[model samples]
Target: GEFGKVEEVKESLDLAYMIKETQNLFKGIVEGSSRSMQIVKDLRTFSRIDEIDGVIQFMCNPCGKLSE
Candidate 1:
């Protein structure tokens, strides 16, 4: 019964083409994920630098005071 089912499935479609298409789809997903991660990393680094700059500027300016 199992062998008959396997033979019937095997006759239905091209396995090679399916495997190739699956591989290409996975490759694109991996590349896109990698690119997205890189962009997030760069954004974090930029935000940190901007925060530091703001702190430095505030410290350097004597008029930057808070009255409470």
Candidate 2:
């Protein structure tokens, strides 16, 4: 009975959700800026360059299995 009372106590959780939400809000602010938009565009271009990265990795897996 006494131990069960401890289990019912409110537990404080870490601030990870607050940090994530604030980061998302800040990201929106940054992305909305003109300079950030240019950087975002550049990022998109760079990201697209790796659009085939997964394909290349997938190909390597089969090749490695075959070479075994």
Candidate 3:
């Protein structure tokens, strides 16, 4: 009976560790995807700079910073 109880405890601990690891992996994937999305958005804004009526636009905000 004592040995069975020890085995159960070990299994529970293993499951907890695996869950934590999975969470960390998903977090990284989400962060990477967000960065990629931002890059694409910035590229779109940059492309629009050349779309004016023969006038080059800075494509920036009032603070002189690139619009996010």
Candidate number achieving the greatest TM-score relative to the actual structure: 1
- Candidate 1 lDDT for residue 35: 100
The regions of model 2 sitting more than 4 angstroms off are 1-14, 35-68
Please list the C-alpha lDDT of all candidates, in the order they appear: 0.84, 0.70, 0.79
Residues 13-63 of candidate 1: C-alpha lDDT, one tens digit per residue: 678789999999999999999999999999999778868778645655658
Give the top-scoring candidate (lDDT). 1
For candidate 1, list the clashing residue pairs, or say none. none
lDDT of 1 at 33: 100
Q: What's the ranking of the predictions by lDDT, best on top?
A: 1, 3, 2
TM-score of each: 0.63, 0.31, 0.54
Q: Cα RMSD (Å) per model? A: 5.8, 12.2, 7.2
Residue 64, candidate 2: Cα error in Å is 76
Q: Rate residue 26 of model 1 by lDDT.
A: 100
